[model samples]
Target: MSDATAPQPFNKEIPTDEEGKFRGYAKARADFLHVRLVVAACGALIIYIPHSWHFALITVIAVCLAEALDTISLNQSIKRLNSGAPLRPELRFSLYTAAFQALLFSGVVIGGAILQPRVTIDMFLICYLFAAVMNAGMLLYFNSAATYLRLLIYGITMILIISMRWMYFAGAPVLAYETAATLLLAYIAFRVIDFVENNFREQEQDKVNALSRQKSMKTQLEVYANKERHLLQLAAVAKHANDSVIVFDKTGRITWVNDAFTEITEYPRDEAIGRRAGTILNGPMTSPETVAKIEHAAATHSPLRIEIQYYTKSGDPIWVETNLVPLPSSPEMDGGMIAIERNITNSKLRQSELANAMRNAERSERAKSEFLATTSHEIRTPMNSIVGLTDLLSEHDLDPAAREYVVALQDSAQSLVRIVNDILDLSKLEAGKLKITPSVFEPGHFFNKLDNLMRPRAEAKGLSLSIDLPDDLPLLYADEGRIRQILVNLIDNAIKFTRSGGVTVAVQGARIANTCRFSVDVTDSGIGISESGMRRLFGYYAQAEDTTSQKYGGTGLGLAISRHLAREMGGDLTAVSHEGQGSCFSLFLPIACTDQSLEGIEEVTQIPEAPTANLAERTILVAEDNATNRMLMSKFLEKCGAEIVFAEDGQQAVDLFCAKQPDLILMDMQMPIFDGVEATSRIRALDAPQPYIVALTANAQKDDRDRCLKSGMDDFLTKPVRKVELLDTIYKVLADRPMMEKPLS
Candidate 1:
């Protein structure tokens, strides 16, 4: 048979729309059969009457009508099923069949009552037995094998009922037949209930299986979708990665390369794959050590990092930082390494350029030092002549006009000295030779000294200057000289910059936990710095880009030096300013307590009067390498009541010290033959009384002081020294010494 016409298995066949219609028709036929049987049984009730023919006719007519009604109901049910309506049509047909059967039976019984009652009753019982069998047989055809057995039992019940009817008519016992029929009916009812229960349970199991299959299908679809999305995201990341990525097997054969690798190497995927890693990429510039490291990583199954030079397809050498990570092994494939390389050529070039720039900067710094030294010497030489001439003029009798000119010269010389000092201080700070010496001093006493120094300058400018100190401020731990220099620089800057409003210096103490902090705030109505200017204000040699620099000339190193000094003394200086408003600069320093004995040391209450011209009695040893500086020092000391002895260098001074045993010895720090530190060491080694040793060196850094003290020098004094500083230092050292041993008298 062709596939379209072939007989299929019962389970495989597609249910036709006509199948339900056919079932409806079959049920209707069964109902009709039952009705005909019931009608025939009723006809038996009128069979023996005197008017039996009329009763039989009425019974036949009633039976025909019931069968016709049953047929109509069955046709309606079939029509409903064909239209895809509910099975309730079949149930209505069954009920109609039962109702029609009862009507037919009733017609027969009523018609029989008009004839003979006894014969009619006897006929009705026999017919009922046959009709019951026919009804049960029809039920058997449509239902199960059990239903067929029920039909046979119902046939036997009909026989017993017929027997019971005969027994009643023939005067025989009826109990046995009636009891047998009742038992058969009960068994059939029980079997029907069992079949219905089994059918529902099977339907429920099928539903559960269907639902489970649907859920499993949905889960598989979701997993597939997720996997597709993840693959797409990975492709995007690999395509856009900035670093070159290449995967290779342990045998060195390239397996894969990302888009960056292709772009960087200028090698297409087809050209690069299956080639040895070193063959295509590595060139003369590539390091053998780097290749060896990669080989070691592949052998040991570890990660490796190395920087190498590689030539691109365009023949440009690029520096690359490469990382090789070993892939985990799998059953289907051998382990390999994934190489991620980043081009660092630009960075490498920048580093080389920076190194060259640093060398140039160092050379420039050295040249600057030499220039400063030469310039300082030359300028001081002229300054000495000018000052000396001014002093000589003051002594000589002169007119008011001539004396005024001399006074003007003196003021200019003093300004030049201040500028030169600021430059020297800045140089010391830049050379990293500046050092801090912590000293215990009363805050009140320190402020008093600052006031004495600044009050005159403020009064000259006609600007109010006030110093405010907290009463409970603690002693400061700092280099006293450096602190004073920082304060003077800040205050001087405030005074010089301010034209109208006054300048104020306020001192306060902050107690935090175990430490006391001392702070100095300097507020001035100066031409304040702009936002753009403030950024570079603290920078070396930087000045405000306004009228301030043009109007009030300065070296621009004071604030920078002050900030450096403050930081060196374990503090910091910061400023707040507005363009048109005033400015406030604050200095924060850690404070300590003053020792009692040190406090008892009497303050110098007065500037000592200059001694008379009696240099014939006093001896001064000058240590100087420069011939001009040596001559200048001798002349200056000769005018200060001392006879001079000179040494060209530190070593000469040491040798002359033991022979002359002069009252005081001068030391120059930087010398060719022997530096001041070494000469002082030799001088200190002598078993004689330690002479008064003083450092007179061009190196004015605070480290110079430490070096001097370490060498057993009694005091430190910078070169190109003012006559006042030199004379004051000499007199103080002499006065501090115990009275010189008197000769035996």
Candidate 2:
């Protein structure tokens, strides 16, 4: 470590006390460097005259080198302290080096005395040693290790010098006295070094204590400024907020109110300040229960949130949502409550309006259902008499002219029946009351039945009808009856429009994942729909052209109802057509498919005939209110070789059932004096042989059928009942009726 290469101060502004002390010590050493050099140089010169110059030169050079090493160590120690490194090891090393430098000076002095025996202990050497010790005590006083070690080294050297002089110069007169003065002077120098070191340490400690107090005061001032800024911001926000805010004491007397509070309640802040909150805000509309809840929360110092209706100064109703919280207690003031309220008058009005609208919609739907049911019964009752009388008239072997008129009458009646049914179905679908009953049936059997039904109509129109079915068709899971109705509509439309060419019905199906996706395409060679018609074809009461309804004579509800039913079954209905070409109406449906084999399930391809020949000797009890329907039933049953007894209403039917114990009762619902449902219930209550009861009525709504079956009727059939259907129903019941034993005549 040379003088030129030694590190200087880093010029970093370290505000801490430890760094300040280290820098001060380092500066002291640097400032006294010239003094130390001059003292050592003078000592070396004094020794030069007494001893050999070579010995003095060697000793001075060694001392200069030791001083340079000590200066380098001091600079390095300051650098380490600034970097936040521990200095215990550096301090210990510095003490060892300083002791070494002291020992070198002591050696120089002792060697000069021993080599030049003619000269005794010199005063110049004593002054030089004392100057060196004083410089070291000032420079290194901050480090106790280095300062104490320097004192110990010099004290031992002084004792050794005294002992050497006392023994070697025994013949001298006051040599002993001179040694005592030397020892006393040495003791005074050591004490002065100790006092300078102690005083310097005390001054450095006071500076450190003062720095800590200054830092603490600066921190406290910053905290106070932040608090003042926060309080100002809170005051501004409260004054401008849109929600009403108020503060009140524990006794419920208002302390303060915001601008918004005055705007919402139409009460001035000055008047509200000292009054209880409830008296100013609560009005005739405010519920006592809600006020009680607010009081309870304030009494307990708890939080509360509620919605209450209030009236303004102008007597207009307002709904408010309030949130209240208890303020923390303090020495300057008792704890208080703070509340924030928002106006919600518009929200409350909207909620009430929505409830009223829903109720009106429900009432309208119920009225529509009742109207459809009543209209169906009224229309079908007269149509039933017309249809029944026409059938009886046709069987009498009438003339050809008369027969043609009867045929036209029957076709018109059937068309009217179809129209009524379509309207009922559409209403049920629109009202969301249609129910689907799923059953497993063979696709082949279902299509075969459709073919048998539509073939006769197609042949009459001189159009060829063909059906194409897949060879590996799976058994379908769906509402078999509804699907049949949809297919019937499609095929009937096809037959009605075609003049010359054929109608082709093709069914294609595939199993994908868990569903069977199938399409039924009913294509006809009749007039096709225009492009404009396709857009509105599925809408209610719509047709392709205005003249089509007049020429074709349809209600135009079939397609709309079919599409609604298709979507309800999780499928859709669509069509493709051209104006001059034919149209293909495709019905696509997805039904649940299974891996169950269809190997041995029998298909009923032939339509069952009513076994009218086997109906002979069967006694039937007919319950009917209409005089014409009674006559028609009697005549029809008598023609079939069966005995019939008639009752005018439901109660009479029950009385006849107990007396006659007939094999079956054809019960009519909606009759006078307790309907068929009640009559059936009474008949079932009787312990007599329990004859089969069938509901035969013009009330064709689904609910009507459910009511009849629920009252213990074995079967239900709606009017105007066809001859074939009525005969078939009775034929089936007769076979089951024999199981109920009839008493012998």
Best by lDDT: 2
The segments of candidate 1 whose C-alpha lies over 4 angstroms from its true place after superposition are 1-232, 313-315, 365-414, 424-439, 454-483, 486-552, 556-620, 635-644, 654-664, 670-693, 702-715, 722-745
User: Could you tell me the lDDT of residue 410 within candidate 1?
Assistant: 69
lDDT on C-alpha atoms for all candidate structures = 0.67, 0.78
lDDT of 2 by residue, 1-745 (tens): 1121122222223223544555665665565566666556656766765556787778778767777667777888877877887866666766777777777777776677667655644554555555555555554445556666776776676666666766777778777677777777767766865676556656555656766677777778778877888878888878888988899998889998899988888888898899998876778879999999999999999999999987776777789999999998999779989998898888888989988988988898788888888899889988998898888888888898998788768777877898999999988887678888887777888888889878867886789999999988787888888888888888888888787898999999998877889889999998888989889988899987778899998999988888888888888889999986888999999998755555533423234577645656667899999999998888777766666889998889988877777888899898899989999998888877888888889989889999989999999989899787888778866865574445566
- Against the true structure, candidate 2 reaches a TM-score of 0.68
How high a TM-score does candidate 1 get?
0.55
Off by over 4 Å in 2: 1-4, 8-243, 301-305, 323-336, 386-411, 512-514, 595-619, 639-643, 682-690, 737-745
The alpha-carbon RMSD values of the candidates against the true structure, listed in the order shown, are 14.1, 8.5
Superposed on all Cα atoms, model 1 deviates from the true structure by an RMSD in Å of: 14.1
Estimate the overall C-alpha local distance difference test score of candidate 2: 0.78
Candidate 1, residues 481-562, lDDT tens digits: the string is 7878888878888888888879999988876654678788999998887998889778878776556667887767778888
Q: Model 2: which ten-residue window has the lowest total lDDT?
A: 1-10
